[model samples]
Target chain A: MTNKLLYLSQADVKSVGLTMAEIIEATEKGFMEMGNNRVEMPPKPGIHPGEGGDNFIHAMPAFIPAMDAAGVKWVSGYPGNQQKGLPYINGLLILNDPETGLPLSVMDCSWITAMRTAAASAVSAKYLARPESSTIGILACGVQGHTNLEAMNVLFPLKKVMAYDPSPENAEKLARFGKETLGLEVTIVSDPKDAVTGCDIVVTSGPILKVPHATIQAGWLNEGTFVSCVDFDSFFSREALKEAAKWTTDNLDQYNHYKDKVGFFVDCPGVYAELGELVTGKKKGRENATEKNFAANLGLAMEDMAVAPLIYKKAAEKNIGTWLTL
Target chain B: MTNKLLYLSQADVKSVGLTMAEIIEATEKGFMEMGNNRVEMPPKPGIHPGEGGDNFIHAMPAFIPAMDAAGVKWVSGYPGNQQKGLPYINGLLILNDPETGLPLSVMDCSWITAMRTAAASAVSAKYLARPESSTIGILACGVQGHTNLEAMNVLFPLKKVMAYDPSPENAEKLARFGKETLGLEVTIVSDPKDAVTGCDIVVTSGPILKVPHATIQAGWLNEGTFVSCVDFDSFFSREALKEAAKWTTDNLDQYNHYKDKVGFFVDCPGVYAELGELVTGKKKGRENATEKNFAANLGLAMEDMAVAPLIYKKAAEKNIGTWLTL
Candidate 1:
């Protein structure tokens, strides 16, 4: 029997034209599967290859039987790469044929990581944020800052973006993209507090750190602000996290796994629900307009599994990817 | 910057013409790095996607800084595939540039898995087996049975083979290959005991089980015998395993991780040393002629990381694989 699979490059993946709404829908379906206990997702296993155990290459695998998606994302994060003029994250996603366990496609994971991660935040915000939420605070204005704005724009009628980064150049780049591509009023902020203070939604998008040098203070966040932490407590202080009335994460097992190793969720509020539970209506999301809502959506493998099949199917239909024998 | 990587199919990987000795050397070097605490290899994490949770797709990642190799082997084992006229194992090995943490190449892992696993057994035998060992007993005469004979032939002056399999046809196939390819006297044993008894070297290559139905008993092995178990404890009974003078495995953390989950090493002899310790001269292997040494080399990701860089380098030099933009 011949073993052949499609290869989708970053350009090819982008050419597939998967909208943020579509990715959010797929991501929500994946969370529903997780909520219903129909998905098999192991806590991501990673290896730190760089000095000081800061840079990591993680293997994230998940099987969503409901979507017939089974695969792994081999992704790496090198904080030093920013100085080396390379992307901080780089890797590939391998999608498999669930029946015979053969690879069906190998695609660039950078785009998927950017989109699905933002979509996960959007999904969390869908349940946790008010429908009329307009302003968004974006910390660490890099790839995720741009993608998060695009995704949040798809969900809420956003009017302005408050962006901050250690590098003013990065914040400016995101502001340019926000103004040109997203057509939103973008304000480059000087401080993290300025970003978080009166925003309807806040997204922390910095690099995930083992020991966070947190800067977001407890009272900086406005009441009823929906906070989506993609950076794993890197920007949010323990006191800041405690201000949330409802605390939820994408996956509790994964959060606890990293929490044990990295000491991230220590002395925080007890987790009110997993994002999936809210998706499945098994637990409440935002109860009152005055209550603070926080969701730490650590990017899950099932989110990639959910969106990857769509990319593969559409790419195959469009004949946009290269096919090679295995 | 262009992100391009060579894609080597099974044919391309085979065309590299890597010898069993070369593979063994690479695998041994990987073990030496592990012994010196220079390699980063997390315990392989897997997900069972099939019915009854019997079938598994595992993500094995390792970083061998000494070899400048960092990558992952995304592999799957579906026993049901054999009945459907497909190979029981299939997947890909992704090699990465250690400095930048970007993928360098993608290659078929089936050949690597088969060859590297057998090379691990041969590396174990290099330390544990007597140099004058001639006869080898092989249980489960499938692909591993063929590869194990090839690897052992590279190390020892082997003259005869005793092969056993549940399927008579598989045993016959291996027997024919042994006679035709290696010019060794082949015997098809009717029972597993017949295969193990009186053999200087024994290799058990079967399916790894969560709950093993072991068959090999305590008295079957001979004095001065070297045993390599690639199939976990599926073939060797607890009493049989206890017969070994010293017990060793590829990695203790991995062994204990699986042991906690699958109950494989429970009540067995304590592992005296990892195979790397023996390779690095930190631990003795076969101390005397009458000693029985056993190594349960549950295949390490560093083995693939060590070998894959060689394949990628050679494939690039030979221009043998397709280069795809990522």
Candidate 2:
């Protein structure tokens, strides 16, 4: 029978007050479950509506048998939306009961995407970064840059951040946020090398696609530095990636799916281990403090599935979303 | 900015009273647009959640550029749901503005699926069946049987109907509905052969997948009989498909995707044309009244896209459905 469905708006999701620590732990649990083979995640199917294929809407569906949760996220990204005064990416996620296949809640996915993606990087940092990591480098200072900093700050006790962006105004804005809101010393740099050089943690959160740009060289990374690439290998040089003592990804299947198109990791060093393997103790993370480790997390649906239930639970407890009859 | 989105329930959709003729015409127009290269349809991506893959949830997305309608339908079919007193299939569809990628409406897709599937068969029948068809035979009397009859009744002035089902009680129910609702002379037969022996149009609406059962032979079909198989070659013999003067499908890409898995359509005769080709006048349908033709309508998202806008409009005019802000 048709029933009333919970609908969480963007404001409601934000009002749920999900902390970075909570999201990171939730996402890590998803990775552990995935390693245990308790998650069913299909490769996302995408629709390219624009003629040039510059934009995409992808359907991400996953079922976590352990949690008895199933859901699908319909998310879209259009680079051109920025110029039109709209968000670059917008999405909606529907959570359903795995047993009956009945929808329980629908929520805005933009916040989830931002938080979960950042949490993925933070999880990698927690496992791979040095315990004394205090300085961070962030290229492409945007929403991801800020969120990633927030996620990493919780684990690393970061004190200083080096940021870079093509646009000076945007870079200055992020620097201001880091210094004022986050209470961390920040430096705005024009050259990308200034961001990654000599930093304890380096993150590349720039635009994705095949673009001819300056790459981070191996010489810029310190021996104990940890690197997280969420932008499809755009910033890291092939030399830097190959030189790391350990290289990993969020999921192997997704890594291989984009390996050819993103034009990286074709014949690089074998993957050290997936994030899940590390979380589940199937593989080691950092054996020594000086070991250079790198992680490439092509975000997975299992993480979204993990965090959506949290949001749904929180929203329900707080009674913070619209309820509509179906 | 978020806006109010239309939400149409099953009752609201039914209250719209969308005529069978309107749906058939809309479905045909979608085919014509697809043939003219004005629609963007990706292969439906599916997730098998049930253990052993007994149940599946599929995502179907389409953008009809000509009509400026874009949407995605999330549909699930769980055969085991019947034992739990739930319907075998349930779905929801979201229509969006193509220009901004903003969702405009969310509606129940159960009624849409039922109507569009029957309309697909009717479209094929209109283009391929004889114009003066009178007598109809239906196998596997179910919702499809009734819907297909409703669609075909608009195209033909039917006088007599012959129906058969594995369950005689179901067959008698359909017979009663035919005699009482449509005022046609209805006959309930025990044998599948008795239903199709001298019918003008024969429709096989049985269950899908590989099954061993009675197959309708070529001898059972008259010279001018037009056969439509909603089932995947279950009730009809491979020889019947091979002996037809012409055979076509709703979409070639989807047909080929399932051709090997379904274990039919391999080593079969070359497909004469797709339904779109006939709708666009790129290929002939029935060249003569005596020609025996066959069509397999696998159902398509373009048909759903066609009919959803109609439902949205009708709901808007009648002030029906709940409006939810997202």
Candidate 3:
């Protein structure tokens, strides 16, 4: 038997309305499950266009052994998604019958990618960011930028947020949304330094830089602040990153896989511990909150694995999404 | 931005009573495409049940370089698909937008697998079976057994067919289908030796014997007859299989993958030259019909790749199945 599929638009996920705080808890639990080998996640290696920015598809399926859930999420990336006015990443997550090898449901994975990516940053912040970290520097206020702000603000005490973007209109809109939706003190910064300076958290989420721009000078990074880069080039030095108390990653295999695919980011090599490894006690967590401590990225399949069941549950309860039977 | 998805049912594949034959030609071409690096296929690692049998999931996406066609097929096999009143394997083939990574179609692939597996048997017989072969020994008359008869009868000029099954009724039905539908002389045998004796072609399809039964004996295997096995255990003797003119398979890697997972048949060791390598001249097809030969049981992903486009084309031409827009 095939599983019933749910079709969700952007409105449906927002209707289910999982706040970022709940998201962080769920995701952290997912990491712990993965650390214990209680989750099924394998690197989704497909085709790449080499250095030419080729089209690629990824099927990231995970079964959270602790939670008793299985999900298969497939996503594709191409530069052309932008040209067609589409989000560059497109995908669907199929929740499945692990025993029967039958799919249970197919749901929209675009928002899952967006929400999970931000939630992973929050996962890092849960263990890495200062508890009272109130000031955050937001770089590149696009889809990722907006979600990052929401994810961070939901889990941490953020009294002030700053954003930097090349587009003045994007910065102004991000400022408006931050204040109106999130109720935080917002600043539209003229310079990246204005965004990065004196902040307890620094978030970098952007496209691959073409000319290798430097926004975080080695001297400019805030001492004892948590910095997370969804993009690899966000930080330049081991010293710049090691200032924090801990180094945490979503998954080591995934990061290493990307390292092989996308290459080393600014020569900062290795990690202190993957978040899963930390959760499993294979490595230690933050020794102190004030050292330039927690660092990580988002390649976690369980984050989506963790969230799909929630979406499936809420959608079924609400009679939401598309339905098909096999 | 969004790819239009076409859905194909099992009913959509029936056309001209020769869809299976067409499927074989497409698979032959597909293998050549794979060897030329024109297809996007990789080894599909799967679940190990830690029981008596292991299952697999194969994800094959192909872009026919000459035809400018692209599709991806995902198939999963659990040893128990039959016991559950379903096919032993199930999957779907998806056609996609090349530039956007948008899925364009979802098709029922159980029938496709049955067809393609039989098609490979047909292709093997075309090259390796004796030119004047008139009689065939059809073993284990179940789903695989029946469909394989269709492929064999269509590909070769045969005068008589024999059947052997534990269930005499199933064997009788197989014999009837061969004579009534395929228009051939048929005999139902009480013993496997009775069926295998004096046959010019041997097509063995069935489950591995749980407790060894003597369907095939090493001494009774005929020289100058094409011997093909559709199950892992049937390939017991490399020397016996090699008694024919050519040795081949559908895909060497997939066969090897299964070999690695299950280990080689205890009896056969010189299983060389897959069907594709033979078709592409990397290995020889048939030096002479009288030479002893064997084509080991191997399933290829390209056959799955080939039919996705065919189904897409057929579904569109006939306006069959459902359409979903993403």
Any residue pairs clashing in model 2, and if so which?
Answer: none
> What fraction of the native interface does candidate 2 get right in terms of contacts?
0.14
lDDT (10s digit) by residue, model 3, range B1-326: 35556655556555413376788788778767765666656555333222353654545545565444555555667777668776556656556666677766666677878888888787777777777888888888887788888888777788888888889989988988898998999998887886776888877887764233435766566767777777755524443443444556667666666566556554454456767666677766667646656666567656776766776776677777766655
| Cα lDDT computed for each candidate against the true fold | 0.90, 0.83, 0.69
Candidate 2: stretches off by over 4 Å: A172-183, A187-191, A238-242, A262-271, B176-183, B262-270
**Residue-wise lDDT of candidate 2 within B1-326, one digit each (tens)?**
34667878778888888998999988999999988888888878766676877777777888887777788888888888888887788767888766656677878788899989999898899889998999999998998998888888888888889999989888988898888988889998888888888898988998885652547875788888888888856776767666788888988888887786656665555778899999999999999978888888788888999899888888988999877766
Ranking by DockQ: 1, 2, 3
Which candidate has the top score in DockQ? 1
Each candidate's B-chain TM-score, in sequence, is: 0.95, 0.96, 0.88
Per residue, candidate 2 scores C-alpha lDDT tens digits across A148-258 of 988999898899999998888879888988998889999988888888877999888888756524378768888888988878677866677667888899999888777
| Full-model lDDT, candidate 2 | 0.83
After best superposition, candidate 3 residue A115: deviation in angstroms?
1.0
**Candidate 1, DockQ to 2 decimals?**
0.75
